[model samples]
Target: MSNADLPSHCDVLVVGAGPAGAACALWLARAGVDVVLVDQHDFPRDKVCGDGLIPDAHHALRRLGVYDEVMAAAEASRHVACIGPRGGRIDVPGTVAVLPRRELDDIVCRAAVRAGAKLRTPWRFEAAVVEGDVVVGARLKQGDVVRETRARWVVLATGAVPQALQAADMCKRRTPSGIALRGYVKNDAMVGRIKALEVVWHKSLTPGYGWIFPAPGGRFNIGVGIAHSHPARDGEPAKMKDVNLRKVFEAFCAHYEPARELMRTGTLEGDLKGAPLRCSLAGARYSRPGLLVTGEAAGSTYSFTGEGIGKAYETGLLAAETLLAAPGGVPAGTADDVRTRYEAALAALQPRFDLYERANRVNAHPWLADLLIWRARKSERLLRRMAGVLEETSNPGNLVSVRGIVRVLFPGA
Candidate 1:
């Protein structure tokens, strides 16, 4: 269709076809709204992620009607293991699914298409075309072809790249910074024998941790992320550019006798991509006329484990529901009313997540790490309880409340 003769305008315009955007589109389209989903990258694009989806994330996919497809296409792991110094280990009985972002993105995007959302890959959002402080639509460019796509509302699912929504001016820094690095490698025999995802806490990498998530077909997603405000930052800080995760990878390989075989012919696919762990604790603003930000764009990522897929999924659904409710479209500042609904939902039962987020920001002593690891190893019940809290099925808030009371009474609990 010609730019002027654009076949149809949608009730909602979703920019960026990542998990958050695609999930929003899928939900809206299923509600029978005319939804347009666009992205700068084509189908099957790769994203840098830890690649493990907690059980609640699976529940989210079930809501979006892609759970079956996700199960079929992605690899699955049933638990997460914490490995500590001196080979102390703990296995928490939980289920986490895995998929390479390339395959998973394609599956979810296709699911949205199946639900009746128009998918436009390789379409770049140029700017928000506004009228009297209202976001009416967006100017889009595809391979030098400039055009316009108008909708009643616009949703930003653009992940960590915040420049796209600068026009909306509704975003703020929740945290000072976020940093991470991840890559894929062949799952060697040792990893194969150990069937759960492993999180290693080494004294040397305080305030940071390393992880090993096994994928289907004998492959693994392994990486580490550290809070940027470490005492180690003084002399020569390791910027995302300087960290050389590959060097870290080699160093990790040197320490793990079991991982040596896997590193023999290791190849780094792409440089590590960084995304901020935007918090809602300090409260960042969201939503404005003609524009609403979801996923990483809104900084909905959890501040603790740096896991955002679940938060992104929840916000994506909320963003769509809010748009549907606001037939007249989103309004500036007042957007918080809609945004608060989702935030409250997350906060009501997610206080432990917030507490963990606070803990992550604090300088983690090796003794604490050792204690946590020891706790994990000592009792499977505690590990399961902690994992349940992580999964969000159990009440993290209630758990935190009890802990707070205990600390108040004992002072060293």
Candidate 2:
């Protein structure tokens, strides 16, 4: 059958089966919309990430009705340890689950499927078919077959890959400011000692940090992400991944007591994959006409830690809610009401991660790390402030005074 002959055109078409796309599809399906989710790859696909789910991410999973299932299916980590230079360190007691991106994506995609959404795996978006001023649908390629599918609304959930929605002509090529490298490790040697997550903060890796997150099935995901302040310092003209991630990991592992033991028997597999980690958004607006952007495409990913899944899920849920609540029923031809309501909900409901983003930038400074760690050792108040900052708490403003006190103690920092 030809593209037009396809009997099942969905009410909403979601591109990219990442967290943003899957969450959006799941939310819409739960709302009784004919949602079709498409991804370039099939289920259990891997994405480069630290692989630790923060509390906010946990809450988002709960909203999608698969939190327990995810936790059960994946390896779980409960505490976070922060490593610093000068042998200064701190451990925050909290529950941050660890699941490989492949498994996590499958869990979310399955949730959407259970909610009555159709999932088209191995289908990639080629281009959008525009009708006048609105996006009508997309031209897709499935292996050797090419098809044009039409939908009422198109949700762009593709992360970092801006080519599909290039028709919008909105994405600006900002300076390549930050660089990230990550990979996975597998071993059974240190199964009992590996915590949920570990972060190493050091001058060797400035503006960014290294992370070790243990997953289920005796596998660990570990990598380092660094932000290059000056373009002159850009490692090289080569791909971003070429920056010696193994050297960085080895250096940290040699010093870290736990990692040193974990590395003895574990195999560090795969090359270091790198990408531009945008510290600031090119544009934070969510929707335009018949098109809507969710998750990293809209720059919803938090800069402090590369944690976007939770925020992406919330954005997807909001988008679905807005579409369902629009006056005169959901818009059938364009994406107007959905865009407006989604933007409003995002601003009002989700906490802005900008502050932590700024703090991460400042963390590049050596003295700042020393001062914070010193103060944390001296005062539980300072430790709480540190916790508040990273956790992105609603009452984080409450810790500003303690932060000020620490600032006064180390004026130069």
Candidate 3:
């Protein structure tokens, strides 16, 4: 959308046109909510991510009515090749795919535009335009040119970055729940060899894991992540590790054979990139008067697997549905009612996030991967449950719990 064509007012002003914001804008626009979607960067921009789309992401794609389009542009996979701490590999079956965020985000965002949302790129969100105690819209900047948009409601779909949340007074935790580093690799030799979405856990990469998902066109997305920096129950302040991301990445390639082979034989497409993650719903508040937060900004990523695409999409849609429930009028209790309802909707997802947090034990203790993979190799029951975790039908915490260990050892005995 052109600057000349920009509207001074919209029904809902959505900040950060990533998955959450874009998906929310898409639903709102489709419902004829007169939503305006804003982003700091242009579409098809590179976003640092593993680029793997698990079952939850697929579920979101289908729900957004762009499943065929995404699949057509994606690298399809049938399972994940999970390598344990002791080098035990387990091929857990699931419908997975890989597409770089450059392509994936554009597809979803453009889908929103096609659904009639006004998408304004190169717009950086400055702060919310608050009247009294309620947010009425947002002030955005594009280079030196500033735009103030008035809206009945605002949705913060900004992913990971907390500056926008802080400006809006919605930030609860200034630090991210985790941080991830990744880079793309182009290699013909590694494509088929690295077909499945591969994740590795090792002692050297404690508090984290490494992933090398094969994207379409013979490119691989390789990265390592420090999954959980602070526990939900830990009252102490979260501290940054003294470790260098590059050195940790080097250790990943050195210890994991596939990564070593890919790094050694493949050409690096770009510089290694890093980004923070908000996980387990621990970073920011869900809602405020006249505003709602969605996506990674609302801590959409999971602590266990570091997946958030599907949840981002889901949360964005939920926000849209909430606003849709209250079509018009700022009655005395309307904004408060919306905030309460949005908080309740997001609260329902917290138990699942807590479950993922519990399952993050494997990141801190790699040996657990060995035990789980070993038992999974022996027990079909255990394997099915692991598969269920990928499909979001099983709790990851149960997979690593005492009862889970018993189930692994006995196997229906």
Candidate 4:
């Protein structure tokens, strides 16, 4: 559909119909708000991702009322195995699942539509419509035609890609914090053997890790990630452009015996695909006058594990809540209140992000990872606690607490 055929105004215009946008639109629509969700791609489109959903992501899906659907359609696993440097491995028990973005995103977007949100697919967001420092709406491109849709509030859920943000002059920094590559492989041998989500840490891939997640139909989602700001062996800063992620992934698969064995009977589904991961480590601005940024656009991905789905869903929910609570659907005078509440909500969620950022630093040290993994293997208490963190039931900071550290240092204690 062309922009000319679309509504000229909406109560809220959400750009990028991914997890964050869909969740926000779903919540707002359920609250009787007039919301319109737009995306650059059509349904069933594939995004480069690890496909693994932790307990946090599952909870978000449940909030969106699609948990049962996802669970039924995706592969479930209760084990998470971490392979540290020198092959030191630790197995933690947790509830996790994997569903390809092609399916997962479609499910969530459909849920939003069903909840009364208008969805505009293949509608590319071109720029924000600002009326003297206040974002009033957005300009969307449909084919060769550009249309203007006005709204009291505009939410930016454009994940990773900075083009829209750049066009709006809202992007503060141009450099991405991390990069990752993923691909799918079909292997009959992996059906039973790979019952758990596995993450491997190699010395060569410091400040990054590789993962193998069990996908449906005996397939596997395998990938690797690295921080662009990773420190080099000579203690110099590493350049992201200089690093070859594909080559690194190939080397990682070849170096690990388990990865090699998994790929033995495996055939890649397609070419390897990659994307940039914008970690919310340095704290990106999440709101302005009338526009609010959510998801990876606001850098909500965890620095250590590169997990964004749950966080994106969270930011979406927060955005919806903020607008819903506003008087008369976010009036021009109340724009500052919206920005303040969103920023405060983001700050309240900062503790977890801070812990993960610290953990990322520790993960860069192979010796520390090896020691922690080796210790976690021998201590069921430590293992269970670690599992709790993955399940989002326990605080990650607890692992490094005085008592928690003592327990890890003295397993029998």
The candidate that achieves the highest TM-score relative to the unseen native structure:
3
lDDT of 2 by residue, 186-256 (tens): 88776777764878777766666777788887888777776543244365432343456557667767766
Q: Which stretches of candidate 1 lie over 4 Å from their true place?
A: 1-8, 174-176, 188-191, 228-247, 265-284, 326-353, 361-363, 393-413
Looking at model 1, the pairs that clash are 78-94
Each prediction's RMSD to truth: 4.9, 4.3, 1.8, 2.9
Per-residue lDDT for 1-413 in model 3, tens only? 33344578988899988889988998888877788888888777889888889998899899888899999999999999889877999999999999988889898888999999998888888999999998998999988888899988889988898899999999999888888999988999876787889899998888889999998998999999997654445677677766577888998999998899999988998799999999988779898888999999999999898998889989998898888776363322388778887889999999999999999988998988998899888877778889999998988998788887677777774
Whichever of 2 and 3 has more lDDT, that candidate is 3
Misplaced by over 4 Å in model 2 are 1-8, 174-177, 228-247, 250-261, 276-285, 332-334, 347-351, 394-413
- Number of the top candidate by lDDT? 3
What clash count goes with each model?
Answer: 1, 0, 0, 0
List lDDT for all candidates, in order: 0.67, 0.69, 0.87, 0.82
State how far residue 74 of model 3 sits from its true place (Å). Answer: 0.3
Of models 2 and 4, which has the larger TM-score?
4
Ranking by lDDT: 3, 4, 2, 1
User: 1-413 in candidate 4: lDDT tens per residue?
Assistant: 11225678988999988889999999999988888898888786899888889988988998889999999999999888888878988878877899999999999988888999888878888888988998899999988888899999999999887787787677866667888988899998778988899988887777688899999998899888986453334744434457788787987888787677877778989988989888863424688888999988888898888889889998899999988877666443399888888889988988888777766754476566676787887877667778877876666665655665676788667
Q: lDDT of candidate 3?
A: 0.87
**What's the C-alpha lDDT at position 149 in model 3?**
92
**Which stretches in model 3 have alpha-carbon errors above 4 Å?**
1-5, 230-234, 327-333
lDDT of 1 by residue, 215-284 (tens): 7677777776665432225655324434454555555666655455554654444554544455433223
Every model's TM-score: 0.83, 0.86, 0.96, 0.93
